[model samples]
Target: MTLNWQCIVVDCDDPRQLAAWWAELLGWRLTHAGDDESVLEPAEGSPQDGVSPDMLFVKVPEGKAAKNRLHMDLRPDDQAAEVARAEALGATRVDLGRPDDASWVTMADPEGNEFCILRAFTPEELATLE
Candidate 1:
């Protein structure tokens, strides 16, 4: 049997604040919270079939330094719009050495956690994934 993906834990100085940032960005609901931890699940009718991993932000004393070892890539319906919206919400564009014609933009969340915003894929293009 294959194991299911449950959650992605993010390390931050303030879990609640980071959780709120992600919840608003992804339109996810806050599922649980504690003094040093917070959890968020995908919104109703989101791509989750009850199996999508939730996002968990946990408190840590250390601040983010150097580049991220792992990062998320987001495919939005309108890349530019989403980028603008996220920027308004404290996200920032980052230089990751991407080529000018690259279909994605690197960004950092409020806590300087890097993630990418990729152009939406067409069905035909997606079919090639399999």
Candidate 2:
């Protein structure tokens, strides 16, 4: 059997804060919260399957350093506008080997998780870029 990809869980010191931040950034909704964990999922009636992926922000003792082994890449419907919007939402730029001419912008979350903002490209546009 083939396994389908599910949620990309992030480890954070503050689960509520990080979940809130990511939910806002992704336009998702806070589906669940607990004393030690919080979960954010696509908004109500959103196309995503109703299963809310736990963004386990477990209590950790140490701070984050170095690059993450797994990271997310978001492509907004509007590339330029979304870049400015994401900046306003508290994401910071991080240089991670992207060429100057590359179309994707690399950014880090509040907890220093590395993710990329790729220009949304149509099938035709993607072919041209490649």
User: What would the per-residue lDDT of candidate 2 be over residues 5-117, giving only the tens digit for each residue?
Assistant: 55667778888888888888878887776657777778877766476443555546678878888887887778888878878989888888889899888888888888888
lDDT of predicted model 2: 0.79
lDDT of 1 by residue, 9-105 (tens): 8999888888999999998999887779999998978767376788989998999988999999998988999999999999999997889999999
Itemize residue pairs with steric clashes in candidate 2.
none
Give Cα-based local distance difference scores for all models. Answer: 0.91, 0.79
lDDT of 2 at 124: 96
Whole-model alpha-carbon lDDT for candidate 1: 0.91
Query: Model 2, which residues run further than 4 Å from truth?
Result: 1-6, 51-54, 123-130
The TM-score leader among the candidates is 1
Residue 98 alpha-carbon offset, candidate 1, angstroms: 1.6
By lDDT, the best candidate is: 1
Error of 2 at 20 (Å): 0.4
